[model samples]
Target: MFYFFFESRGNQTDPVVIWLTGGPGCGSELALFYENGPFHITSNLSLSLNDFGWDKVSNIIFVDQPTGTGFSYSSDDRDIRSDEEGVSNDLYSFLQAFFKEHPQFVKNDFFITGESYAGHYIPALASRIHQANQKNEGIHINMKGFAIGNGLTNPAIQYKAYPDYALNAKLIQQADYDMLQQKVSFCEQATKPCGNQSNAKDSCDKAYNVCGEIFNDILAIAGDINYYDIRKQCEGLMCYDFSNVETFLNQDPVKKALGVGDIEYVSCSTTVYQAMSADWMRNLADGIPSLLDLGIKVLVYAGEYDLICNWLGNWRWVDELVWSGQKQYAAAKNGSFMVDGKDFGLQKGFGPLSFLKVYNAGHLVPMDQPKPSLEMISRWTKGLPL
Candidate 1:
């Protein structure tokens, strides 16, 4: 539960947005240094200000959670979390303590935001916060809304988009798509019992394995292409490398600056990933309708180029969401998401929910299209148009 907070450079009263990176096990420092943090790690192993960092418009917190990721750790194995309940509770506790300690920013508008697997994390955590607030939770957080970027929220709906996305992107042939559709059909069947109805670990784990093969099948056809950004090729096993973040964080002077005495920086922990495996196929989107019903704004945005958690999947899930605003949202005309008077993406929304499809970017929207991503968030948190 180690977190880094960066004050807003624009306004002290601006919203506080906490960022969570997704590996199901990745640390948020990856977002801090590489994506939307105040600074970027220079080639000389030093930090340089990032002009497009989100902190320019709002206070930002990048946290490492679930006990085994990043500098956060526990001696007890019981501390390791396997599902959203434990994960959400831990984050709720952290926020309570954080707001209590930093009372200066307590009244400022708060937002939950992250990329990738954070799709799963954000909705669950939001539901937890809303429930706790309803029960007269301590230190009422002025939560305004949350935004997810390239996240995997509804596995059943999202998984079904895999074959169609691959075929539309021309990454696979018609025959390959035909085969993948069968995999999707099997995945849907396997995932049914794991939906909002049950939390059976064995059933969920089986669904996770079965649905995962869809991606493996796509990879088998599309070789060496980065699933994060289909436009690029992986250097090795990773589409993009953050070894430099690891190197810089491990530096003696850097660790001392951060007061992380001798704690090794883990960019991603496989143990945490394995622990959360059975929770993967569970439909996190099931929690969203309630949040939206309470007027908790949700913005689901995705980088169109990503294959792993592609915009197609995100769009489908958001569109298929059964909120009160569902009909209006479906009927809403697609609008241009403009940055500097030019269209950077497409967006659609009604009341408390919105979806944006960012162009010319990948899984990490902020990293691929920095200025526009910053513009998107600045407008979003301020209740301005996207």
Candidate 2:
């Protein structure tokens, strides 16, 4: 069984949302404390309430996935699914059991959400859920929509936007900027094989090595800066010291409370990352149009200041999506995203598709601007304007 940390207001009228974190291995335990989950990690290394938690708007399940991540583990190494398809199948089964165990939530409207690598996970899982919903493949879920923050949905095209994003953000000089433009061609060529699932695993491995060099080039120029947030410099050993999270979860009391015995805890799993390496560069954007066509809502939000999966690339891919309202969606005017009478960000969306450019935020938008993030989810989940 997967380790799922469930939180609810117990309001039967509200929707249920399953939240996943990226890394293909970054367990949702990180999301539970670090992002939109109810708790905060205090200086005392204990849990505190987050006023802007996503649970306020819906019943949320924070899952530690991929069979070997966080508290969720299996003795069989092959039990883990390295690709997006296996991950989705595992989650689908987990959800089936989850609803069976708690039948009260079965009828509630449901949604799936995640960030970073989940860009790929969300679309893949959504497709599976969509298929299940249509074919009666499993217990019917009132699947509503999906939201991704600073996700890597379309790495192939998103990679092309990085050089321009750096230039526009003033992170690179004209000489360096031109160099990035020159590298874009090589990066795209190298990324081709990995862009499709039909290619050999070796080709995908090659794409990661070849295309990743472009990012490495940018990192060389912008030394000691946070790739997740360009406005900030790298913090401590791991860019941001989540050591406390690792430390906190490892406490005996916490482990006992979580019901996972004797298993080691980590914020992310390196083994899972290596297993998922080949699927990393494959384009998830290809799945979005079909998802939208299925009438499943797609909300892609990005932090304006992030460098890794920057806003430019996110917006570009959303606009590139082919659908019934292609022209109107592209021409839709961006409006201020207001919170407490203050303009927090700008949003432009139409029909079931929407994209928000979160101002003054980074890769983890909720961690950066919690109130606005909450408002964004609450709005989209309720069919409110983007």
- lDDT by residue (1-386, candidate 2, tens digit) is 55554556546668899888898788787878888998889989978999989998888888888878887888899987778888889999999999888898888888999899899888888888888988987789898889989999888888889888988888888899887776788878877777758445888788788778778888899888999888889997547778888899889998898788888898888999889988888888887787787678989999999999999999998999888877989888989989889998888888889889999999989999999999898888888885
Model 1 worst lDDT run, 10 consecutive residues? 234-243
* Over 4 Å off, model 1: none
Model 2 CA RMSD to the hidden true structure, in angstroms: 1.3
Q: Which portions of model 2 show Cα errors greater than 4 Å?
A: none
- The Cα error of candidate 2 at residue 232, in Å, is 1.5
lDDT of all predictions? 0.91, 0.86
Cα shift from native, residue 128, model 1 (Å): 0.7
Instruction: Name the lDDT of candidate 1.
Output: 0.91
C-alpha RMSD of candidate 1: 1.0
